[model samples]
Target: MISRSDWLRDWQLVTRTALLILALTGTVAYAGSQVPIGKPPGESEPVPATMRGRFAGFVATLQFDNEAWTDAFVLAPDRRWFAEYARDATNIRVKDLRSGVTLRRLRTGGRKISGLAVSSDSRIVRAVDEDGKPLAWTVATGKSVSSEAEAEGINRIDHLTIHRWDNDISEPPGPTANPGQLISRFLASHGLSEQLPDLQTIEQVTTSVDGRYVAITEGYLGHLTIRDLSNSSAPVTIEWPEDWCGHYLASFAFDGHYVVLGTHGDEGDHAFTDAAAFEIKNGKAKALWHAECSVDRDAPEQISRDARFYAIGAAPNGPVVVWDLRAARRAAHFEGVYVAPIISADGSTFAVTKAASKGRRMLVLRHGKRRRLDANIEADPTGPIEDGVYALSSNGRYFAARIASATPGGKNAVGVWDTDSARQIRTIEPGGDAANSWKIAELSNTGDIILLADKSVFKAGRWIDVTEADESLLRGRSDSQLTPDNKHALIKQDLFLASFTLREIATGKTIWSLQGTPDLGFVMSFPDGRVRISPGAEKYLKLVRGFAVKPFDANAKRQFLRH
Candidate 1:
């Protein structure tokens, strides 16, 4: 089975090539305009003073770049500490989330960080290096909790590998070839699955919540090397039963007290197998329970935040089943193929999109009770992303659904529902020539909705339509710029800590741009159109052009250390 790392490598290659083309052509991928503050839809007058003040506060305090290349900002469960990795991946910083002050910065022994895991109490942190070695450090003391021998054992794997699909089709090479072998021969004659290596030394490591146990799975292998972080014992290697002929597709449960491995075999047979769960106690694992199930190869099991419950899309025309991992049994089951089953971080609620006969529906489960948020809405065959059907709020407090019309041929609308009450909080229906057929672009942590069609932000019963400011009238440009006509020039400064200015060619109108961090900065267009400053410091400024700048923030304390 193909691993996520292989897919990510392929995606990075494609993304790099696409960014090169965009940089050469001097094109802005998306507009980065701030969400506007305005009245709710259909209201002529502005919103109430208190609500307006809330909107202003929302835009100022919370500004996170969603399109950054690195997943640096990770908040601990307690929300006390936020660990941020450098853009170059050389170091990491643990910052106080409440005050936004830097606490400590530590280097990663020259190996780039591939994954990070923090404990629930926000006192311990576990960072996995690119070489699959795990480092456990105390957040309060900045001291290593792991010993040198344990770190060496974690990185002792001599080689890594990934199983190639092409190798499966190769003939057994003998007097007689079976039907499968004949098909493989035919495919090989056509020059398929050639040149790609079957395995390599690149693996992904995942850790438990308390930073005690870690499971290292190679990209192409079915065997798993489990490490006990809190103890000095040797790593334990586990594989599926020989009869299953299973390969490691992904991790089923890699958090909390138990670690479950997911395996996938041939289609229509045992598509997915949880098979067993290992309970970790005192930094040692013992076989606890064996809960086995059949699921499609594409649909892996989804676990709740606290690792108490898990949802699986059953295979071969099966129902979606919710499993109670602690009980080692099935908890609930629902009919039909539901899409995007997301559970709350606390495991208090769960959300999934269902396909109803009349139309598409969103079903939320709270305390063993199921309620359909949108029963009559039309089922959107396509989702926001390639594989995702609908977007669910991270906390499972809300979900976004595209509302199908009650009439057979009526226009569709976008609706946001509150999961607690199973009630539709807001519905955005565009009339006449308005921007209709909208998809959810973002769902903020504060339970606000942002539509992709016009960048309309819906927060606190208000509509902040930014189509005029964000969506330019230019034929090719997709950046936020106020240009009355193509003749007038739009210039921006404050790209760096230094100062810069620009003037229009025909009218000679000077435009001064203010200071913005690399995350919020914009590009500037020169008069002759030959020179242009680019946005996306990591994409254009850092990756392709090889630029590096570290701006100083006086409010944040700084400390650096070598490990």
Candidate 2:
């Protein structure tokens, strides 16, 4: 995932690049037509006082074509003047709301303005530059007006929040208690809130490869629980030391007998203090090994299916620590933010991007040796940099990366490569026009098939529209998601109701159906028709053949919210 800072920087870079391209091409008409300048035509009529507020609200939603970067807006206290600042441009556009005309453009002399605020009297506009320095301008004359004290008094809107117009609809009132309290009450009713007074909520839910085991964690406190879905055995809960900070990373080993947990220090600390492997046996968890490591909070971490290796690290410029769980030591440490670090099921092979390199310089590590393969993934300046664009097969014998079009107006494609020989295997390009083009969603575990966002499957060197093939099962559905393996799909029957159905993608056979309310709670279903839901949804959760639901104990409910 791209950080907010990175996303904003990329947006600015793209805007600047577009401007430079237009300048070099000598396209004055193109630039003039795209950018809004001066007063728009027919602004003589004065907006009615009654409608001025509504007009200002409408103007707040307007954006120039090149204003694609981060921006801010401030309406004067009287709503007579509006100030706008675009990160890509070095000027603030002040408009007269009453007359519906551009009043003045305040230049910042190339400094990037990040925030904007208008004075109560509508004569002065204060701004904070990217460096947090104060700047002010006169609205009437477009002259710089420096007043440190005045700038300090202004409350700036640092970043503008842009929401879809349809999202303006008011939503129903939320629960009186916080989400954490509600989750706690729900868990207590299910008899799963033992020794968990600090349990805020279910942080994450991870399932084993075969969907037989699940590992859940309490986000606030360092509590971990592993449950076996194959049998009716009591879950094994592991609680960390009271002084040890929370655990944000947890994953089940591919074999389902072991799990890995990564811990970090208190708030503001990004380093991982310790990562431990636990062996589960006889309904109990025993610590196998613990290793100290530093990993970024947003970094990627993965545990091999064989339970022999675990990889964790930060990105951009952080260490990628690959630990040998069997030996309880660090096997290899690579520096640089890797696009994706994937370990083979057997721990004999690994695929990752080259350390500190531009473009997708891929490297495959086999038997403690590295071989470089230039994937030549093109950069898409018009879009934010996406993570997980590259995927490695479980066997680590195949690699796939989403590739941009070689030329402008060309179709994007996905390239697959042979890891062993470091050779290009094939490039699969989905068919569609530019507007409705198919995007690469996921690469199959084996790297032989690719799933597109439009529910299309690419296999055997051809694209198959699964939506068309399974029309009977998907017709009139609100939303649907095909399993990673493309064998089954989870479908929602309505947009405003909680009605779901699990169906086989190939045969259109309904495996099970469920009906509930919007607040029915968290639900997770596996490709094999196994469904697991939180206690809040248990009352309405119906499964044809899956784990038995625990009866809710109303007597165990606690008043988590204080009066």
Candidate 3:
């Protein structure tokens, strides 16, 4: 009925139609592949399972069933272990991050604990109860020991305080504690005498960054002993001159080659404190230049990352003096007293909150000039400014401060200021008096501020609410933080079932997650590529060490800086 040419053309048309339909279906499948799994209905499109597994390297070290609450948590210096003591618990539990195993359980005599400190090797945990009694226990044996100062007290007022030098040093003083009894008992109980420091006189003990050298201050004004733990010879003891009343090792040089010590005593009828540096190789001490200024006994001094500069809040209500360690001279001084002075790693910039003429203000000193931050905020003030607490970013790009409200009956607000332009870029009020004097938990290296906004943990610039219910379930939630690269944020979020999520900071997309208590504290990352998290058990923690990959898209990476 039809010609042969006509029939062939008809067949070709049907085949072409079929091919076009197949191509469209293939394109749709590829688009769906980009969606991520477990995304909320309205959050965004999902990321493909392929891409999620691309960065799959999270290894869980410990898993246990334990409830988490507001507790005193401390991570060891080496990032190998951590300790958690709950407010209502009777025992302090220590766990190893690498193995997720209980290292020790130090019993507290039904006393409320106020603070905690851990030794470098995770072998010792010192805790102070509500009654001012400090007890030290060996991690392996859980054998408790007390110093003379801790044993006998008048109002039971023991003047001993557990001090942490920088982030790496946590040395609780056994000052008047019997070293013979403490070390012998620990050695005999653990059968590891050769692995411990065999020395007396622990006015203060600080370990080097590499854990190779141990510096111990004998009496308040006594000699300092630096023992090379790897070497068998006698430890190097550097005696302080007779006039010095108190001598304490402040910090170690970045290269771990020098130690800085502070000396305080009556110098010519006036009490004074000066700092000096000792080269570990030569065992010789060099005195750094003093500011002719008195140091605050309560507030700790701020040291630069390189140990080349020291900013001492010259007595309360005095100007902050910046000392140059390399030149051993006074570099510069500010006009107002600093409650907390922050120094950049390079020693090129300094930030502090000082008393202003009208109210408290924050100032950053750099390039021999001072830039005022509070005056440049964008808010319309209806009243005078009030007190504020500020935290600086690691790169000196931005600073976040929770300043008291300037309007009648208004709540306090948190503002982020740009250090480069010296202006407020963003401001957020968490809607309550609870925002007043908000304690900054952790500021990521990339300038993201993780702080306590009201009762919830606010990340970057937004409030992370996980449920329709109240926030009573999130009571003990500490601050969250971004990894060093800023690509991923470890935020405590409710998976609707008590869990945590590692969201990509740029895209707001969660890359890794686990089911656990919201009361998790991120311990430091180790060189071996392990990331540790606290609250491993109800009272313990687990270490997560795996792939350190960035899963941010190009657009997401740009957004991290935009905000």
| Model 1, runs deviating above 4 Å | 1-296, 324-331, 335-339, 377-398, 405-412, 418-425, 430-447, 452-563
lDDT of 3 by residue, 452-502 (tens): 544555654556543422232232322233343434444432211223345
Clashing pairs in 1: 160-200, 160-201, 161-199, 161-200, 162-199, 162-220, 163-220, 360-379
Per-residue lDDT over 1-563 for candidate 1, one digit per residue giving the tens place of the 0 to 100 score: 66896477446533433332332233324345322111111111111122122122110111221111222345566655556553334445555544333454444534566566666687766677766667766665455565233333222111111222223335554433332333234324433214213223323444433345555555544556665555545566654454443444433333334444445444434334423455556655566443233332333235553445556553222356665644535566676766546665456677666555665566788777888775455454333112222456656777766666545666766667787788888765544333354555445444666454444443333455655534222111212112222222222211112122322323334332222222223222122211122223212111000011222221110111000
Evaluate all candidate structures by whole-model CA lDDT and list the values in order: 0.43, 0.48, 0.45
User: What lDDT score goes with residue 53 in model 1?
Assistant: 24
Best-to-worst TM-score order: 2, 3, 1
Pick the winner on TM-score between candidates 1 and 3: 3
By lDDT, who's the top model here? 2
Which runs of model 2 end up more than 4 angstroms from their true locations? 1-296, 337-339, 355-358, 379-388, 433-447, 468-563
Candidate 2 overall lDDT versus native: 0.48
Better model by lDDT, 1 or 2? 2
